[model samples]
Target: MPDQASPAPVSTAIPPHRGGLPDPRHFDPVIFPGAEAGEVWPPTHFNFHAPWMHEAGLGFERDASGGIAVVRSFAHLRLLVDIETAHQLFDLAPGSRDFRLLRLIPAALRCVERIIPGDPMPGPLLDEEEEVPEEHHLYAATTAMVERLAGQAGEEGQALAEAMRRVPPGPGMFEAAVARCITRFGFPMATVAPLARRLQRLANAHARVLATAAAQPDYAAMEKVVLRTRQPLGADRGWVGGGLLTRAMDGLLPQISRPRRASTAILAAAEEAMRRPLPLEAPTRLILEQDGYRDRLLDISVFWRRLSAAWMTVDPDTTDRREIEALARNTLRRLSLTSLYRAPDEP
Candidate 1:
């Protein structure tokens, strides 16, 4: 035998489990090397376990901070724990000098398990299968989203959504008309209620201020109504009609006086009082003051009413659930990110 080749040095390196996650049913405790202790693993760089697998994959990974974090992709629910918390959570043997990859999977699953029902799959990620809605399913989802977002604000938030939900048929023509304003925006069902209530209150308050303006033009009292009207539907300030008011005031003030009197005095007064202007236009004030053109002003002021009408609007034959979900998810995300979107001060 010509120089029998020495047995090739046995390689001990283990390749990544890219074939997809191992079957949890047959999983065994995988003890990590003691030497790897205290060394941080990069994200998705599992020392032992693979990522969690679902239609979307699941698994915990070392987050950017090099600590273990379990995240539910939908709703962005996340739980972070330190080494000791992890040990306590998984009932790891004290002083074992090893980490078990299997322990983290349950942790990750628990994170997903905690998501509120009807919350969509986490987004900016691919859309997940949501329940197909019935005739008014979009409305239901919209209300559900409202409840969740409001609940996040505290008890007041919950009460607000509920109150909006129970709002009886409008007491008056204007209120009823206000309630229907958001209808043409293709906003179906209860989703329109909260927004309608918001718009209604603002419109009523605006009408009062305008009425005052047309008669004695009580800048002081009108200012108070305009200021109060700026309050948002819930704790989410962004949902308020402040932007709508400003634009309306801007248009109304310039054209308010017959000869196009510069509205600087009224505008300055509104800016001083409300921190923004009122949502009143010359025509709306004239209509409210004279009790005419109610329908015309409503048609004009319901935010993109004409644009929605002119477009090839697809009426919800059933329900465009995904669109409602996307709206809810995005709204919640923005509210969460907004510095001002916080729980109301405890009474």
Candidate 2:
């Protein structure tokens, strides 16, 4: 009989059932051998799972340091997904938003390997050439690519097609926009933490003030007067202006909030924001600021083959135990691998 080599080691795959409603695991667990254990669920790697299946046909694995790494590097072709697992934590402008925040996803892992050459983070692996947007060519280019993905027949192909349908409305849709940013210009979030935190605190305090303003009788009358101003209805001018005016309308809500019932709504939202804090740059003031870093892993070639197979094997997902625990270790090893990207001009 002809000699046969051992079957290649399988890798970890992001399964179909994305961690649902009440629980959104925004990161991938490194359920591989020798991975780390932490309170962090969904180690951001899984956030780009869709793009992996759709594009590279790969899985997850561990690095030299026993961290999680993607099997195949990201390609510029096919569905470009950017999982924005952290952006919602603040009131970031539509302009400066990072879109890679979802859970159970697979995205371009190259960015994680390319940090600037001299920087502390992973350099060559994450540093891609800067992308200059071609606003005029945007629509035509996006439509063409979206159609290509949508045209596929199988469920996997169809899923990518459907997601492409909901490309997020904006000057540059969400998924593609995220890729362009990270691949071309990676985000530096370590320093962004303090500003994000302070902003969050202010938002909480403002909510409290709003609650107080809501209860006062005089504030109601003042707000009524502002409504009659008959100003133009631009996005901000009308709604937010009215909101601001009403709050300051003799400060009824603020007054009512005395002994302030920071009503459960804002408080809950605030807590959620904190729990899923955006990956803002680590603050310089932080005791040991890990200022900037990439989102994925290095040498995913070894990591993914072992990971995807394992993920496909025992994924029961009971809250008591995530079936993908083995994969978590792979993710942990790469946590220190420095997720950076190669310059677009490289090869």
C-alpha RMSD between model 1 and the true structure: 27.6
Q: Ten-residue segment with the worst summed lDDT in candidate 2? A: 289-298
Query: Candidate 2: where are CA atoms >4 Å away?
Result: 1-22, 26-32, 37-347
Question: On residues 108-171, what C-alpha lDDT tens digit does candidate 1 reach at each position?
Answer: 2222333221233221111122122222322332343344435443333344444445544232
lDDT of 1: 0.31
lDDT of 2 by residue, 1-347 (tens): 99999999887654422112111121343342222355232232333222323343344332454233434445622222222212232222221201212212222222233211112321121222223223323343334333443453333333433444555633435344334333444533433223334332333332332222221122122222223221221123324344443333223322322111222332233323323323223212211111110001112222232233233222121111222222333333323222212221122
In model 1, which regions exceed 4 Å deviation?
1-84, 91-165, 168-347
lDDT for residue 182 in candidate 1, whole number 0-100: 39
Q: List the residue pairs that clash in candidate 1.
A: 51-58, 52-58, 52-59, 53-58, 74-122
* Model 1 per-residue lDDT at 97: 23
